[model samples]
Target: MPRPEALVRRAAAAALEETGARGAITVLLADDAAVKRLNGRHRAKAKPTNVLSFPAEAPGYLGDVAVALGVVRREARGAGRRTADHLAHLVAHGALHLAGYDHLAAGEARRMERAEARIMRRLGRPNPWRGAT
Candidate 1:
């Protein structure tokens, strides 16, 4: 909606604050092509996802977050949510990952989801996993 970069930075800052994580984070707001390339190169996933996080090794640097603008827009349209809200969710999700949160297991998923819900609520947005089983 407004400036995607500003939205991402604000959302990320909120997430990092909520998680008590301190560091400088970088976020890339790009089209599907750039996200797809990064996904393929880093994760071996050929398709573009809504967001991806790459942790940094340098001190005082948290990590890099990449979001596919097209993908996020499509998902927001499908979910009946505003693009800006959806962007905040994805950025928070990526920031959580940068903060060492994961959902590879069922228990881990529950933990991560709870954290995400808290972040979304703090942002005055709905929980992104409201309908999930």
Candidate 2:
């Protein structure tokens, strides 16, 4: 497998292509504490999550995606997936969010998951939600 950073970049690119997002997106590999702060400040969640997507305000810019290393590692272990694979999934998920996909509704979730599956498959990764309930 490629290095983690490489996997992340490739996944982001694939997601952008799938969603037809123009311009650029920033990827931040952050620690739990940093992510926790961001989550609290931006989302009011007061906890670190595996990934967070901040969509750009303008049309030409895609936005930013942040992943917490520690949280992601723990989640990947719990999910019985490789760290790189999990990271790739998160990157794709974030990109999808930047492209205006959301799971706030059931139908929207299904659509987003389908897009994720397709993007991951194209990146030669396994379906992240294969056994998800």
- Per model, state how many residue pairs clash: 0, 0
Candidate 1 lDDT score at position 118: 90
The Cα error of candidate 1 at residue 18, in Å, is 1.6
As for candidate 2, its clashing pairs are none
Off by over 4 Å in 1: none
Q: Candidate 2's residue-wise lDDT over 1-133, tens digit each?
A: 3458888889999988998877789999999999999999999999999899998887688899999999888998998999888899999999889988999999999999999999999999999989998
| lDDT of all predictions | 0.91, 0.91
Residues 12-127 of candidate 1 have per-residue lDDT tens digits of 98899888999999999999999999999999999999999999999999999999999999999987889998999999999999999999999998998898889888888888
| TM-score, per-candidate, Cα-based | 0.94, 0.94
Q: For every candidate structure, what is the RMSD over all alpha carbons to the true structure, in angstroms?
A: 1.1, 1.5
* lDDT of prediction 2: 0.91
